[model samples]
Target chain A: MPDNPQVVLKITDLVKSFDSTKVLKGINLTVGHREVTVIIGPSGCGKSTLLRCLNGLEPIDSGQIELNGQLITAPGTNWSAIRQKIGMVFQNYELFPHLNVIDNILLGPVKVQGRPRQEAIIDAQSWLDRVGLKDRALSFPRQLSGGQKQRVAIVRALCMSPQIMLFDEVTASLDPEMVREVLDVMLNLAKGGLTMLIVTHEMAFARAVADRIIFMDDGHIVETAQPEAFFNNPETERARRFLNIFQFQELERRRA
Target chain B: MFMKAAWLTVSLAFWGLILSLIIGFFCALVRFWRWPVVARLAGIYIELARNTPLMIQLFFLYYGLPRVGLLLEGRTCAIVGLAFLGGGYMAEAFRGGFSAISRSQIEAGLSIGLRRFQLLRYVIFPQAVAVALPAITATAIFLIKETSVFSIVALPDLMYVAKDLLKEGHNNESNLLLVLSYLLIILPVSLFFGRLEKRVRFAGFGD
Candidate 1:
């Protein structure tokens, strides 16, 4: 049976290499409508590479990425169209440091989506409130804290009305106290049923929100399982070892 | 006696700064375009103008260029010298501003489907101006001081009027009046520009 047109996104055998090293060997995944899938891995495990490749930020050596039933990596693909449908939030926040928060949110819809400025601004205002930064619309990125900046980044992506959102360790740069605020925004995003693919180190967030957890290691998908089963009874040795590190840290925190 | 020369100096400095800024803007754009030959040529010209004395540069434009059939009036030569000197330094200042902007910002602009020129004008230029404003103000001050060199070209600038007043028996009083004249002109303009710079900066255009 063919997948639904609203299936959101699919990637098949995505391969990417940098110089002599292969960052993403081959990856395949599907994101369903209104589902949240979080990819978890150790550092340098190609999780971020996979997210970047899916969004066309990093060109894949070979693969088929389909968003809204449109082939994104096919020959002569309309990349602008692909990007407009798929939004990405980077770990570093990547909020245009020069633009005010409101301007940043409106930039994509007005400029790329060709919406009127007034319409875009109104939409941006609502999205800013949704992300909990309505009062910060006039502030510069440097003026905002890490959490606020991350919220603005999310709103910036959301304003594009992307059917699928990809986040590459979105809270990785936040302070311990600030991390929760940013993740709280992501939780709200999840509650809204945004189709999302997230590469994250935040295990609590993965367990709490992800419908599916994909564990990647050495440029390969080591395992894909529901968050509860994967955390409770991981099958792959790589997944076991990765979970061991986090579990040990959690145990130490509890003992303390 | 120094009042007339002070008026002349103020006018020359004001107009010379404007001319220099116009030339600087284009030179900065040419540098920003990163045309290898053109960029190198701009670099050479700036170095030549900056390393040499402003007075000598003014004299060369006023007197020496005439020998090669490129004669211009003394005042015109002064403006040319100031513009060339300003263009050279401002080009580098602009290049610095360009480098300071993050690559992601440019990519973000492109991802939004902004054409190359639109990207530069709307995104690149506005942000670069915020970064370049300080250097621009500094260059303007340098250009103002440079207008004093026009006296060597026999232009009746402030310094020229002051010298003439002293020679015509106004003595120490001319020196005091000249100093006061410079204070009136440069102080207000610099303060106004400085305030404008702060406002633009406070408006929070960054990236």
Candidate 2:
């Protein structure tokens, strides 16, 4: 998999610790070009930690993460340059509050990438229109709904034209009705062949969108399988136990 | 004569506020960015200015400096004194605003590939300024009041004329005029800050 030219991200023995607690314990994974990889796990299971580490938000104890055939975990790696290629969407949809929708979307492309303002705006307008938010381009972040903000955030990341996108529970904070709009965007992106590494609790959405679903627990990936097989028949007892208790199915199992 | 004295007070407060804003903004930036040598220097300056009385600061600038052969005009001393005292408060107000920004905001800026300097220029600064405006307004008003100490340097400011009038027979009229003179000076400043605050708030900054 490491030798495969199609692979966009490769992680080997990724380990991360915070003050003494080992949040990510020696994990290995690879994501292929345009593949939608979804990570699902219980709270504090290091799913979020893994995504953060991948995006260079946290320092790892000892490991290697290669993106697009470059070893990014090496010291002296230009993280700012690397981050442009790896777009990330936080759960909170941390939009720039002072900026209007168009400004927030154009900030990276124009300022960081040094693209001309007119050119960046043209691209931003296209993405906003794609997200069904072109009319609200003049609105500030505070003026948008949670779902709208999340969509705008997605558009902002997409404007960067990143090699891969990392989503860390992008819909976790939204109301139930708002969740679908965000999930629908992710599904559309998946269909559009964008490489994505997502950490989510939305099992149904995960099953629907992921080309491969990774189940993690206790700071490790316990199982990796196709959605249909993993859902219908989990291989390990841990996977089976997790799949049982993860949702309303747990109560049904107990009742049966 | 009273109008001239009040004008003197207004000019001192106005120039002093300008100098202090410049000094305090740079000090706050130096401290907020944690620039190695300057951060410590700014910290010591803030502590010294805040702990000591403005009168002592004026006396040191006006009188003590002459002993060291560094003489300055009385008006210079007054303006410099107010700047020295008020700068510390403004730096603190700015720091308070910087701290109020969430860690996520910084992270979001970094995520967008903004360099450290660019992050400050684009993200941290505008938000911090917005958050700091109210505190800055209070500091400006306080500095205007601190101009009362300018008379200690014998600057012939409003307070000096008020004291000068005390020696004469016109006690009630002098004191009342002194009080009104201050009102005339401070009221416009207070109103100006109020207008500025409304402008920033309307533009949707700080919160």
Candidate 3:
């Protein structure tokens, strides 16, 4: 890790609730400019809700989120501008089924950013080539495989040149075989030093790529540590139990 | 005389459908936005149009309103009445289309920096049109049939001509001509809409 790393996102005492049920409770964290922070938790732990709040998709009850020193959670903030800096890829790969690969990638740039369509197309083609889907430029989402669709979704976000990207279980809805292809793209982006925050259940990928792992439970951050320390020597009982489930699953796979 | 009335009916149906679609689209948007006072007003309009019979609505506009100095020609009254009725049903159809869209789709649009109107235009409307086309076509057909009811208000539509011909001792010929004229007008229009529906049907992502 580099000394004096620039912090790109800072969260302080963030709280969110839905109908008296608190989802994210007093979360505090800072993400470095090029850090890959992976959040792991059980279902309903507010991992997705936290990511959603960062993008202003979900309103917060209290606290503030600062993106690159800008108050993103402030009242009446122009979220559209903030969102252009912070891109998100959902679990379901919400590609517009009506649009082809190139069109989907060009939508944000050409339509939202007012970039020249031809220029955006050329850029989008390069991104598709990088993902090895250049030939699929004209292919609609339904025509593509799950892995292909997810790759296009990543490129769609990348085309915007966002300062940070949030991926919420992007590979969760993919088939077992398709997961590796999407993970490879994420790994490539990580190697390229793109700032990312991911919520995922893939423990091996987390261990390999995460600069830090944040373990959450019951809408609270139970522990935050480097992957090596967190995996080998969990500091709390909750962390240990959570890791055990992964370990048990791994052992069962080995036996099988 | 029969041909003249048939042309009048066709023209009335065309104008009535155009007005209905425009009114319905905006009404649907109002409800979708869910503004407090305007949404309730739109709700009341839709309810009134849907619950009351078209004849009474026509009579109120053409006859009843004259007492309040809001007089309109018979043709204008008929078109306006039919449009109001069709708009209510069309609003529901468009609302159904809007509701069928997944929230994630809108989230994706917003996440990529699309403003509300841009999101509606590029992402939401295309998909909603796909879902709503069949219903809209059906409503158009209903609206065309509804124009026949305007004859009761002496608008000189096809039915009015047929009634006059029957009273002049040409009952069999007039009834046959009436049925054929309706079939001739409706069949081609229905087919055109059917083809439009097919062309716009979305090839949705795998189930």
lDDT of model 2, residue B150: 84
Candidate 2 chain A lDDT trough over 10 residues, lowest sum: A1-10
lDDT of 3 by residue, B1-207 (tens): 788999999999998888898889889988888988999999999999899999999989988999999989988998899899999989988988888789999999999999999999988988887888888989888888888888878889899999989999997899999999998999999999888777666454333
Q: List each candidate's DockQ score.
A: 0.29, 0.64, 0.72
* Distance from true location, Cα of A39 in model 2, Å: 0.9
Clashing pairs in 3: none
* TM-score leaderboard ranking: 3, 2, 1
The better candidate by lDDT, 1 or 3, is 3
lDDT per residue for candidate 1 within B140-203, as digits (tens), equals 7877877777788888878887788789898888889877877787788789878877776765
Encode model 3's per-residue lDDT on A113-229: one tens digit a residue.
999999998898888898889899988888889999999999999999999999999999999999999999999999999999999999999988898999999999999999999
Clashes within 3 Å, all models in order = 4, 0, 0
Model 3 regions lying over 4 Å from their true place? A2-4, A252-256, B202-207
Judge candidate 3 against the unseen true structure and give its global Cα lDDT, from 0 to 1: 0.91
Error of 2 at B188 (Å): 2.8
What TM-score does each model's chain B reach against the true chain B? 0.90, 0.91, 0.96
State in Å the error of residue A57, model 2: 1.7
lDDT of 3 at B184: 96
